[model samples]
Target: MKRKVLSIILAAALTGTMLAGCGSSAKQETPAVASDTGAPVSEQPAESSATQTGTSGKQTDGKNVPELTSEPLTITLWDISTEDPGKTTMEEAVQRFMADYPNITINQVHQQNDNYKQQLVVAMSSKQAPDMYIHWGGGPMAEYYKSGFVNDMTEMFNTYDHPDFIDAAVAQSTYDGKVLAIPFGGLSGCDIFYNKTIFAEVGVEVPETIDDLEAVCDKLIEAGYVPFALANGSKWTGSMYYMYLVARHSGNEEFDAAYTQEGSFTSDAFIWAGNKIQDWVKKGYFPDGVNSLSTDDGQDKALLYDNTCAMMLHGSWQVSGIRADNQEWYDENIGVFRFPEDSEAAAKGVPQDVEIGTAIGNGFSFNCWNADGSVDQTKLDACYVLATQYFNDDAYNQRRLDNGTIPSIKGFENTIDDANMKVVADIFFNASNVQLWYDQYLPASVTEVHKNCMTELFGLQKTPEEIGQEQDAAMKASLAE
Candidate 1:
């Protein structure tokens, strides 16, 4: 409830629009930003940047920060960034951090996003946990904190100068009244990225409602173009469609109730979303064998790039990813619009503006534990400096911006030169509520069941009723445990 209220307030405060709207061209993509070096490099007097300054969040890091020494320290850092933009940006941050501290070695490892959670679990079980790792904060984060894998960085934050982040970002990274992770990227909002050239050729306007969307899809199919590019080989890709459909069909009320086990997963809204997706599938709207095509291998983008598909419902990060591969093509072709609303649901008084996305993208959480189960002070201090200072600096922010990513840290308003990114920013900041992805928001066990249900749901291997019952059963058992 508090999170919702705070989101509403933040939404109200950010009602203003960006300089360029969605229709603008990408002639001017990169903007120069003046970086504020809040945390200093080793070349500077480190004492000057360690003073406490900003304060507008919860959690207190009361743990001790060990004094820095020139001793050699090798810390492993794990993340899911095997693809463009993310892959290069994270790697550069590591290089800069190492240069700043010549003695500290960061063994950076990139893992595929689809299998990251399972790999992390296996590593921890095998007693090979990375010193610092990336995660989407929610149930899994809380579970990790409870199991003593999280290191509270509130004390480090209190003692060091850090960039000002949105309250929502801080809220998610915090667990058990402690700051467990550091925000690494901008808010990730989900929207429909359509091919502008294809739309013009098909002679259809941008959709305003689900009815309009369906009409557009029919026309696109008649013109021999796939309506959507979806690679459900990664189940979360299909889950995005299910999420938005459910949100539009009944608003956040049903999902909120369903998630808490207070309402049935077989409710009218879930069934409606399921039925709608299957109906589209029968119409040959998505790529053939979407469940077999992998987004990790760039198969989804392949459809759009070749003009075989007219649109893709995906995260705002798709902007950066697309641009990284071909800026000229992206500039000439890509345009963004919010997911079409459900007019019937809105007329029935279900809130239609509750968006779905993450307030913080991927956050880096520290696990500074020794073999003896005690905090490793030296490691904690090094990671603290690496995350809060090196990773959040202006140079790093510029590189992210160059890749079309807006940092979660504040004060980049004048620097977002890309029109699509500007449009996404406006949509993201003004939403009444942004729901986190269910897979990331649910517990690990429930998440597995949910993803499996998505695969089966899209494969037409199970009835909507069957998956709903399975989900309801999973939810209830998870709650009971």
Candidate 2:
């Protein structure tokens, strides 16, 4: 498939609305030394006007900062942000970066969410990877790093003085002790977001256990509400439940062992998770035709907005969309809660406080070398600068906050005024253990089995045992490959 390259001029026009919301601001102070987390020094150091040569062979200032090249260069940036806010934030950030470094041209490409991972893999294999791209840093990125398709950004991260990123956020992009990507938005994790009005009407408080959640669902159903709004057609949305259940049942150790091929994927915990999802389906907890609902056009959200559903389990990113749909409803009616723990797991000594999702945030990765194994030093340097300026720059970080995103950058949390966003951020900050999303944490082939089996399990076409066996077979196959 041919990739579409968007023009900078067209991008500017499309993002005018976002530009209006994210009005231009004065540049902020640069950090002196980089750390994964905590506040950095706010004072800017004085520098000589004359450029100095650095030992790394790059042109530098008196502070040893690499000077940008004057030669015209066009770099492509691939990201999965086809909607507003994210798209706009990215475009506006790029435009600003371009204005600062006139010689650098960015051809920003937006790919559909579902197509992004596969497309990136193909592009990398074909030696057509973009110079820089937004990616979920975990197993998939580690794969790319192993194949030598990703750049090690540790030096640049250190060179840029660390930028007040969260430790978990930085660790997500690090592979083999090398930072491979820049941490962008805030750390993300999945949780149950409920309609306060619906819960109030049903006289049910936020659930704290599997039984409580089921009781709440029953109440919602009895009160003529869809118990849960699930976009299982996307598969990954449904997988969240399974992932959480498995986490509750088995915890991270067993899951990691299976992922690493040290244990079997067809464990009791995996089977129980699959069975529970099927049980939920049989109990009418999910809406009719949930298997056909699409998460991509906000269809799942529509259920909550229309008052058809009482709750939905989703990631922190959902806050932005909900706020956009109805700010008042989001502020006054939305309530966030962690996914309740399974009683069986709790009885078995599994900690209820452990979260089932990852603390990793999304960020951009630079393609260090060309397909034929050639390095473009100038392009690499420019890519790092672009990534840093767009994500770590304080002004752009404010834009992220305004967009209802929890920034991975430190100290930006104080700027967050959105109550709904703050709730999500609190959950992220308080999570005892944040397990990476299964599809993103496991190998690609294993992820495929996970999603497919989840879909089948939800559809009631496969038993939990069958799904576990299928997943195990796929995992073994991937390991053999």
Candidate 3:
């Protein structure tokens, strides 16, 4: 029998207005809250003998009773999918969940992607925090977890059957051996996506090493095509280049040491990365005014689609947008590749196959604790039901794949039919190591330094050593706090 997968309309009506303003500005001071109580205010589930099987074929043996109170309840969810098809997919899931549990009301709030992180932090520190919110799980999440702004879902995650959850997704959401959030949506990482037509025009092929990549760039430039499409106005887009270069040069151990403050950010690896990016800029490898182009405006994408640029380095999340905008062109001409190995790094004994990015995914974190250090059991339970329905349910997972997201649920690979999605999954699954994005991997203060310095490096305003020193200073200041 053919299964009925949830059809994503891609026009899901968002239910709530923006609770916070949009901007890159963030509050520097942490919110004043009472000290941690060492335990959640809500009652922990006791041991149980009864086990229940969910439709996904996973059995739950936990003591969490699935009963809901007869009284009406409402919970809020802040998410970064203000536009289709993400908004539509989430809306449908919410509708289905509400139908199943008529007593609970979910106020789905949508936020623009550009200002989500900043606004979320502001909301969390204020009285307007939602019962749950979606976020990229990494350093920002780590800060939230440390400050007790979010709840520990370690117990809840274990109680549920998660046979389909991907290991990388789970690891990304876990911190200090505790599951802090529910794995949601697709697993993403940065990769090189190029126009095969342009490569053919320049008589070049996908490069396997740093030298080969530079050679390809030269040929493309000689043919009057931009070697890489870049937009640094938002900063993070350009940071991808620097991040990959650092990964190739230093590998994960050194980067981790530097991020955790056991070592200095002003390392030889980091300086080399900055130098390489500035060298590429000097070589006219990027599009004009790369520093001023905004990625949100599709300027970088326009270069690739029109064949004005030969390549782009971005996360796999761009796959859906490309296919949606031009399916036929994408199917026939687009090709994906892992970032090439740095020849110098290889010569210095760095592994040739080490990937420069991470398999980071977005997920929902429970606002389990309130400003007064109390947990509303009903709200927490209701939030869990909604989160699991959206992320863990078979139909919802199918919807994610159908919408071009590389779902974090195990066994989703078999259901995925898109050629481009398969290629991305293959790259993600085969990667030897995946480091989280530097901006997300480091504290906010240090991330700002990294992004600013990356822009300055590309603009010829700062030397590699200067960029490193600035980042190291920021890291020390953040660590000191």
Candidate number achieving the greatest TM-score relative to the actual structure: 2
Candidate 2: C-alpha lDDT: 0.70
What is the clash count of model 1? 2
Best by lDDT: 1
The Cα local distance difference test for each model comes to 0.75, 0.70, 0.69
Which portions of model 3 show Cα errors greater than 4 Å? 1-48, 51-65, 356-360, 370-374
TM-score of each: 0.83, 0.85, 0.84
Q: Per-residue lDDT of 1-481 in model 3, one digit per residue for the tens?
A: 1112111210111111101111212111111121132111122233454243233422122323344455788878888778778888888888877776667788989899766666765665554667888877667776666555677766656554332355676677777777777776766768899998888877998898888999999998889988999988889999888878878887766677776667766787787788888889989999888899989898899988888898999988788889889999998899898888887778888865556444436778887554356776667766766776444454555566656676665555555566666777777777666677777667666666788987898889989888877877777676655
lDDT of 2 by residue, 135-229 (tens): 77666776666566677666655554335565567667677677777767666668899999888888999988888998898888888888889
Error of 2 at 3 (Å): 24
- Kindly list the per-residue Cα lDDT of model 1 for residues 349-416, writing each as its tens digit: 98888787887787889888776777887898888767766576666777777766677765564467
- On TM-score, the stronger of 2 and 3 is 2
| Candidate 1 Cα deviation (angstroms), residue 203 | 2.0
| Cand. 3 TM to true fold | 0.84
What is the lDDT for 390 in model 1? Answer: 58
Question: Candidate 1's C-alpha lDDT?
Answer: 0.75
Q: Which stretches of candidate 1 lie above 4 Å from their native place? A: 1-67, 370-374
